[model samples]
Target: MLQQVSFPLRTECPPGACVCERERLLAEPDADLRPLRLTRMEEQKLIDRIEGIASYEELKRLQDRIRTNLGVELKITPSPNEVRTLRGIVILLEDRPGLCKKVRQSIPAAVRKALERHPEITYAILDANDLFGM
Candidate 1:
């Protein structure tokens, strides 16, 4: 007697081709998800770094640090209204599949908090929708 084994279908999605439920949930701001909490020190450090951002280069470095340290991808761009100020800069946290749900939920708030505390980066309208577009 010969036994046959069947392999499961691939679970990973190609770039820009994901249609999974998890991805859908992550994209929804109102979706109920457990939050991942950062330590007090980590939050403070993030806030300090955001407050210190005086140029696009610093923002890029901060993105790199976040990706490396937190295993999360964020696309940061300056808003179209002004290039001279950090106030309108936009930070888009990539909602790619397989990202930790809790982490994905927590970062927007943390970043928003940082932006609020920043002297130069404060948004004229400190709305999460405007800043993070999560």
Candidate 2:
């Protein structure tokens, strides 16, 4: 039998603080859902809504709406100079068991795909190991 558990969503900041509510919702097990359920038309509607947002508050509201409605977390990171120069992205992935091997096997293809997607992102390099101060 499936049991419903209600957990209080806690935030370190006030209700409107950056990512507080989304973090709380993410922490709740019952809130996790797949993003693939949204149809292409619905996704287009959301993209239009996001594009129309004019302020930070509106953007945050849109993010929250997407998280609740679509269950997709959009992670946008600024590329460093090396990454922009097509030299590579030195990503120090978490030092866990077999992580190095996994990164070595997977990151090159992912990097290629990213480069293909963004003209500005010329290259990507994932350094799963500590290669500094040798």
Candidate 3:
């Protein structure tokens, strides 16, 4: 039972804040779905990485790291969570069905590599909407 939900994209929406509710839902860790499961610290690290992004050059570097290390191209952009009234950037790695599960599972390694290799990314979601359109 998958459906398409529209997410608003702000003009200056490069890593504003993350829409929390939807992300919470996707990250609930129900065995039925394989949303990336991160420990609390890891989650904070992920957010830190996102917040660390202060410039476009840093963003491009993060993108390159993900592609080079993970062999995946990602679209780094701002994402908004209307329910939580927050906005942040999310890294769109892939969109094919169930692909997020794979990405989510691999996020820890990816995050470590990206943060280590660049040490400047200072910055990171998985959702169907975020998926197809990220």
Provide the overall lDDT of each model, using Cα atoms, as 2-decimal numbers: 0.51, 0.38, 0.42
Q: Against the hidden reference, what TM-scores do the models get?
A: 0.38, 0.34, 0.31
The better-scoring model by lDDT among 1 and 3 is 1
Error of 3 at 5 (Å): 38
Model 2 segments more than 4 A misplaced: 1-33, 80-134
Error of 1 at 51 (Å): 8.8
lDDT digits (tens) for residues 80-116 of candidate 3 = 5532211244445554322234344355445444544
User: Which 10 successive residues of model 1 have the least lDDT summed?
Assistant: 1-10
Which should have the higher TM-score, number 2 or number 3? 2
Rank the candidate models, highest lDDT first.
Answer: 1, 3, 2
Q: Give the winner by TM-score: 1 or 2.
A: 1
> What is the TM-score (0 to 1) of candidate 3?
0.31
Q: List the residue pairs that clash in candidate 2.
A: 89-125
By TM-score, who's the top model here? 1
Worst 10 residues of 2 by lDDT: 122-131
lDDT of 2: 0.38
